[model samples]
Target: MRGKRTTTGAAVMIGALAVTGLTFAPTAAAVTPTTATINASCGLFGGGAATLTATQNGTSATITLSSTAIKTPLALAADSITSKLTMVKASGGTTVFSGKKNPAMAAQSPVTVGPLSGTVASGDSLEFYGGSLQMTIFGISVTCTASAKQSPGPFVFD
Candidate 1:
């Protein structure tokens, strides 16, 4: 009876470890191509080429946008840009990621914001062309939209 109990305990321990390993393995794979490009238009604030970078760990993900083409109208303080990124899912509907993440910048400096957080799923394809990026700075609101489809196609998450 003692020998049987020892064997059972060992089997349970191995099973638990296997489960834990499996749960964590996919998180390391990350989303592919990590970076995408878009030609954005922001009206009076001006528009230009922008880079969107992404990272994923399991269902959690983040995206950051930076554009030398778009310049800040004034110097900004860190975490002062109230921004929301809306993306169209290939399957339909939209997902929005909003955050206040920015580095302090001098007047007319390139605009950049976020490592904004959102939830994503395996096989999810998202694009910015049909959506918009809206940002609020110093009581003034600026909106940017992609002029065409993002390069290298839509972001396909793993």
Candidate 2:
């Protein structure tokens, strides 16, 4: 009889722990329009359509830019290009994400940068138009600006 009671109590405790774990589990974050596009022009270097991908976790976020239209004129070693990307806020003002993060690229390879980290708030709308992307490669600074607002609208974070 005592053994039966002990077994039942342990089983109940295990069930309670399972329920507690489910109650405290983290939830998946939601960010509207995970992808955005812009027509960027980097004078003298190159430019065209570029894709920007965004992800959010709480107040921390990341943005990655990739473009087949913009290619490196020369080979670039991994994490060698210094890049700073500015973004406009719909409510006014701007935010910047700068880093020297990239993969090695051969001459004429597509340009890709980031996983650039930034801080964002819920309901914040970020667009690239009024902002700019500056990349310094081998001492040459190339500035790229969005010709217009990003398509599919700005990224709305939650």
For all candidates in order, the CA lDDT equals 0.90, 0.91
- Candidate whose lDDT is highest: 2
Local accuracy of candidate 1 as per-residue lDDT tens digits, 55-102 = 888888899999999888788899999999999999999888789999
Name model 2 segments beyond 4 Å from true.
1-28
**Model 1 TM-score, 2 decimals:** 0.81
The model with the greatest TM-score is 2
Cα lDDT for residue 43, candidate 1: 71
For every model in order, what is the number of clashing pairs? 0, 0
Q: Give the per-residue Cα lDDT of candidate 1 at 51.
A: 97
Please list all clashing residue pairs in model 1, or write none if there are none. Answer: none
For 87-137, candidate 2 gives per-residue lDDT tens digits of 999999998888899999999999999988889988899999989989999
